[model samples]
Target chain A: MSETWKAFKPYALITPQTLVFLLFLVFPIVMIGVVSFWEFNGYSMTPAFTLANYQGIFTDVTLKTYLNTFKFLGLVWVATLLIGYPVAYFLAFHVPKLEWQILLFLVCTIPFWTSNIIRMISWVPLLGREGLVNQILMGIGLTQQPLEFLLYSDFAVVLGMVHLYIIFMIAPIFNSLMRIERSLITAAEDLGASGVQIFKEVILPLSAPGIAIGSIFIVTLVMGEFVTVRLMGGGQSASVGKLIQTQIGSLQYPLAAANAIVLLAVTMLIIVSILRVLDIRKEL
Target chain B: MQKRALSFYLLLAFFCLFVLFLYGPMITIFMLSLQGPDGALTFPMRGLSFYWLGQVFQEQRVGNFIEPFVRSLLLGATVMAITITASVLASMGFRQRFKGSTVIFYMTIASLIVPSILVSLGIGVVFQVMGWPTNWFSSGLGAHLTWTLPIAFLIMLGIFNRFDPSYEEAARDLGATDPKTFWEIVLPLIAPSLLGVGLLTFTLSYDEFTRTSLVSGQNNTLPLEIFGMTTNVTSPALYALGTLTTIFSASLILIAYFAYTAVVKRQRGKA
Candidate 1:
């Protein structure tokens, strides 16, 4: 082959990916940014640029939606970490056999392969007013009436989000934990480090990357979430995603695009800050 | 070290509860799905039967389940093929030190972290602006690719990282041409990772909803159909559909696991 052909081989090979990425990923985001500045009338969108969409973000509804989204993000993040960390810790430290570790990890991951929507809705039967939990509570005479707030409330929304996203937390944390050399812990103990001391000084710092990655996943997903909040909150709650969806449904494309761009910017900022803290490229 | 610690048992109990928390709702839905035709959505099954599962097929309220199921499968397979091919080629390009490699790599990561709804909306708007009606095979495929290709690229990076260049160099030293060496040596070595990537991309594409929702145009995928039914259809038939899709996904995972293990075992035995 000629020198030019040799040099061009990699670019030629990458053309398909580049084309797909540019057309689908980069171009669409650019389009969103462009469309956000465009004008939208009641019936149709126009090409005129304006800041009206950005101004729309200052409304009480938008403020509440963002606050609600952040609230969900904080709640789900802490819940998933509490649940996920211990599970990942147990698997990484306590599991005596490699096969058993793999088995348990796979068990946790199986549900993740299924539809998240199905999994979210599955909570309806368990948390509904006449559902199993309420039935059991009443059956045990624990309450006079079924808990009305069990379903279609903030609690249910958090529960559903945590259920769907906890595995994302576990997988990354488990990976980071597994990567910690056994000898490091052994050395810590040999140097008279207590269990908690070893964990705090050694294990925790090393797992920071995993926690950061998991947080990125949970935070971004929660920030942009619509379906879970809509379904579990029973339309009682609104999220930025839901707000954008409403705009889109109403054919307010420019306004929705603007909301979406803001959402994207916020999510990206969170992710970038996390990436900065951890520099997870090495871990990846 | 051989003796079990007290903390181990506590952790084990916690792990068991977590597992139950994860699988409990699924099992509940599975049982509810077997409820008799007269039964409602909640527990205490009026009678145990496959009536609702049957209803999933016979009922029109489920919104063309069969066609959408088939469409999702076709789309999954197509996306799987494209993702594998594109990722393999891209990973090859990535192996070399190129001028724009970081740009491409970051773009893939950006594709992943960007919200799916935004991507869907943007693509939908783009299609609308161009007077092109978004369809499953074209625009929907493009949308799915935006998600799957990034994941596929990352998997390929891991695969290629572990790949030894010495083997390819040895093949070239033995007078094999570049294409011939890649086909005979490199391809075989990476076949397992390719299979793994294929499985990953397929499952991701199969269960995909948010990205597909806007670009899917008139036709619904299985998840989209189920999402629609959640609003109107309040019955065990919904659970039946969930049970069925879970079964499909579980079986795919099982088959892939077994195939992967068999290949590993055979390779180990030969070595």
Candidate 2:
């Protein structure tokens, strides 16, 4: 009776979560794999297997779109890291205390407290033809007319993504930086290391874990992104996400599922590679 | 020394400029929402009127568009409940040193980073094939859960990972049964996380678009309504709606944060 009870406890504990996962997570993914091979008419998919959907994704137009999406992903990733790093650095090292640190961190996150749609729409009015950026530029005589490239451009998409995701970058770096013992820095100082030297040798090396975590999030999410790309990219940018949306919207479920599988595969590989490099499992 | 001062000034200037760059557009939208069709976007002479605001609330097409708000609220609440339950169980399960735990944990991590567009499409396709009813009380809730669960699980796990297990052990040693120890001792320790995850899950569900758009089928959440409004008619009423939604969302976030913080502080005091 004791042995049976002991075995039952863990099973009982895991039952609910495992059931949810099987119903919602694992099952859906398996179903996606199954559905991607089906045939789709105009309105709905047929219950028959076909590779036409996968082949359709390799068309010249889609290929171009796929390539553009990758380009956008690369741009967002590099830009976010370049801009986000220094701010994160300032927060981690330049900030004096934990209280102020948390306060500043809260400031960064407040914008995200609102809906993402609201945040993105906010960009439209500011960058629209009669918007503020144009007004400022016209006021300064920087352009003869309102900048046509302001609102519906890759620049806007990257700007919105970076603005929203900068918090993701900062949070992890802050967590890792906070974990570094003050004594380590003091010890480096005792050994006659300068601020830059300590940062380069000690701080940077140790904070790599956080950097890995942040980059994983930024890179992966940016790649799979649809909302920012679709909204700011002005229907011109066809990211994998947007493509998937188009498929689903037009009732091309099989194609969408295939695209999703490819995306999942790409992201899983990126995460696995990053995990190998960072060994984040050990940190936890 | 001069170079160092220059850098400091430059940093301050950059950060200030960035702040404006980040929020400048939002403020402009807020101002624009108050304006009417003509020179209201411009200055002087014409003053602000409640024209757009009235249009948003009174016009049958716009004013009566309260269904999405209700739908969003319903979806958000359902997602909150589902995610909280799933995350708590998953957290506890993962906490135990079990076989294949690493694999399960990694899979959950994968869900966190996978793009919303991708998983949403996959899930949508899966549901369509499986012929899951895309009704408000059925498919809508499931779609919302897909987006909410991963983040909720991550947050709950983060909290649970930091928990001191000795409390649970102590409860068990005190003649409390396993389930009793878990409910009375373990749950309280992780309650703060539950609240935080609930708040975030609710927020995500409420604002969710890509996933919602795919799986919603005919269901129109607030985000879906906004999408339609933006694409179909570039009316200022949309801006008014956006602003109102933003305020509603911001208030929810503030309330949830305060409630969670108060609970956490009180729990700590009791301890």
Candidate 3:
């Protein structure tokens, strides 16, 4: 092959993958950014530039919704981390056999392949007023009335978010844990390191990239989340995503586009901050 | 192994609870779907019957599930083929230091983190501005690609990272051209993982909601239909539908896992 063709081959091979991102991702994002600056006439967007949409991000309701989203994001990130890290530690260090480890990990992740909406809906029967948890409580005479807050409150939103997103946390943390050299742990133990000391000094630091990736996944997903809040919160909550969805539903295109812009900026800000702490790409 | 530690038992118990937490609600949906005609959304299964399951099959108020299922199936298969092919190609290309590689890498990574609603709305608006009508195959297909490609890329990245390039060098030394080397050596080594990722891409597209929500343009995908049912149908029929679809997905994944495991074992044995 000629040197030029050889040099060009990799780019040519990647063109299809590159084109999809340009058309679907970059162009559309630029479109949203442009629309965010345009004026809305109550029905359609006109050509004039305006700051109203950007200004709306600071409005009381908008700010409150963003706060609520951040709350969910924080709760879900911490919950998943608390739950996921131990699970990864167990699978990576505790599991004795490779085959069993793979099997159990698949057991944890298999649900991820199914419909998330169905999984969310599945919670309705388990946590509703007349749901299984309440039934169990009343059946044991623990309550005079079924607890109403189990399904439609912020609790439900956080619970559903945790349930839905724990996988994102577990899979990555497990991946990082598995990649840790086994001999490092042996050496640490041989040097008379206690279990806790070895763990704190060795495993946690090595798994930081997995934890970072997991945190990014949970934070971004929870921040942009609307469906789980809408489903589990039963109109009792407001998220920035829901705000955008509502505005879009009402034909408020420019305002919704503006919300989209602010949301993107906020999401990117969180990710950038995370990247500042640890570069996830380097591990990859 | 050093006699299992006390901490191992504690962690084992915790892992058991974790698995129970993951699957308990799904089991409830599964059991509730088997309830008789008089059964409700919650417990107290009146009797055993397939009444709600049948109801899901012959759709009325919840809209036609079958058509949306077919559309999702088609979209998923299309996405599976394209994502696996594109990601496989790009994964190879990425091995070389091509121009704009960092930009493409970040873009793909951004594709994963960018809000799906934003993607849906952005693509929906782009189609409108371009005066191009969005269909499940056109705009919907593109939107699905945005979701699947990044994931496929990651999986391929994992597979190719552990791949030692000296194997390819040997093939080249044996007078194998680039295509011959890739097809003969690289493809065989990566085939099992590719199969798994392909199936995963198909399933992800099949169940995708947020990205496909605004892009599907009238002909709904199964996820859109199911989400609609969540608002309108409070009956046990919803559980029945969930049970069936979840069962189908579980079977597909379980089968793929075993098949992948078996292939890896056989490949190891041969080597």
Candidate 4:
């Protein structure tokens, strides 16, 4: 091959992938950004640029929606970490056999492939007024009446989000934990390090990349979440994603696009900060 | 030293509970799916029968489930093929240090983290502006590709990192043409990763809901159909659909696992 052809060969090979990426990914994002500044009439959106959509988002309702989303994000993050860290640690460190470790790891991942909507709705029978939990509580004389607050509340929303996303935390943390060299821990032990000291000094720092990656997944998913909030919170809560969806439903494309752009910006900021803290590129 | 520590036991207990937490709802839904004709959506089963499973086929309450199920299957297969082909070519290009590669790589990653709803809205609006109707094979396939291709690219990056280039060079030196070398030597060696990618992209496309919601147009995919049913359909039949979809996905995972193990064993034997 000639030098020019050789130089062009790589570009030629990458053309199809690049085309798809540009047309679908980059173009849509650009479109959303452009649409965000346009004017929205009651019926249709016009091409005139305006800041009204952005101004509209600076309201008490939008503020409450954001506050509610952040509240859920904090709760879900802590819950998934508490549950995911121990499980990942156990699998990586305590499991004695390789086959058993793989088996259990696969078991944890199987639920991830199923439908998220189905899994979210499955909580209804367990947490509803006439559900199993209420029945068990009443049967055990734990309460005088069924707990109406068990389902269709903030508690239910957090439970659903944590359940759905805990595996995302476990997978990354377990991967990073497994990558840690056994010799490091052995060296710490030989130097008279206690269990807590070894974990705090050696294990925690090594797992920072995994935790950061997992936090990115959980936080972004919770921030842009609509279905879970609507289904579990039963319209009692509003999220930025839910607000955007409502705008889209009403054909208020400019406002929806503006809300979406803001959500994307906030999500990207959180992810970029996490990336800055730890270079996940090396881990990947 | 061989004796287990107290912390090990506590951690083991925690592991088991986490497993239960992950699988408990699924198992409960599967059991509820097996309820008899008189059974409600929740517990206290009337009796065990496959009546609800039968109801899923006959009932039109949740829209036409069969049509959407078929559409999802076809779309998944198409997305899987495109992802594998595009990712392989892209990974090969990545082997050479070229200008603009870093920009493309970051773009793929950006596609991965962008909210699915935003993509759907943007695509829907674009199609409307262009006077083109969104359809499953066109708009829906594009939406699914935006989600699946990024993941496929990441997996391909890992696959190519471990792949040696000397094998292909040897084939070329033996008088094999470029196409012939790629087809005979490069492909067979990387077949295992391709299969794994195929299975992953297929499952992702099949179970994709949020991205396909607005852009899927009038034709509903399985996930879309199931989402529609969640609000109104209150019977064991809904559980039956869940159980069925879970079974389909689990079977795909098992097949992929066996194929992967077999490939590894054969490679080890040759080595």
Better of 1 and 3 by DockQ: 3
lDDT of 3 by residue, A152-199 (tens): 889999998899889999988999999999999999989998878888
What overall lDDT goes with each candidate model?
A: 0.88, 0.74, 0.88, 0.87
Residue runs of model 2 more than 4 Å from their true location after superposition: A40-44, A47-49, B1-12, B36-46, B49-55, B60-63, B267-271
Over A95-156, each residue of candidate 4 has an lDDT whose tens digit, in order, gives 98988889889989877877788888778778889888899999999998999887889998
Find the 10 residues in a row with the least total lDDT in model 2 chain A: A5-14
**Predictions in order: chain A TM-score:** 0.97, 0.93, 0.97, 0.96
Clash tally, candidates in order: 0, 1, 0, 0
For model 4, residues B167-201, the per-residue Cα lDDT tens digits are 98899889898789899998999898788789978
> Which 10-residue span in candidate 4 chain A carries the lowest summed lDDT?
A275-284
Interface RMSD of 1: 1.0
lDDT of 3 by residue, B202-227 (tens): 88898888788777887888888889
Point out where model 3 deviates above 4 Å.
Answer: A279-282, B1-4, B164-185
Every model's DockQ? 0.79, 0.51, 0.79, 0.73
> Per-residue lDDT for A269 in model 4?
88
Local accuracy of candidate 2 as per-residue lDDT tens digits, B1-271: 5755666666667656666766676666677778755424322213466667667666555335678789888878988887898778777777756666777776666566667676566666666766775655566676667667777777777787788888988887888987798789887777766777788788888887766666676768888878767665556677677778877777777777778888888977987
Candidate 4 achieves a global lDDT of: 0.87
- Give per-residue lDDT, candidate 1, residue B213: 78
To one decimal, what is the Cα RMSD in angstroms of model 1 from the true structure?
Answer: 1.6
Would candidate 1 be rated incorrect, acceptable, medium or high by CAPRI criteria?
Answer: medium
Docking class of 3: medium
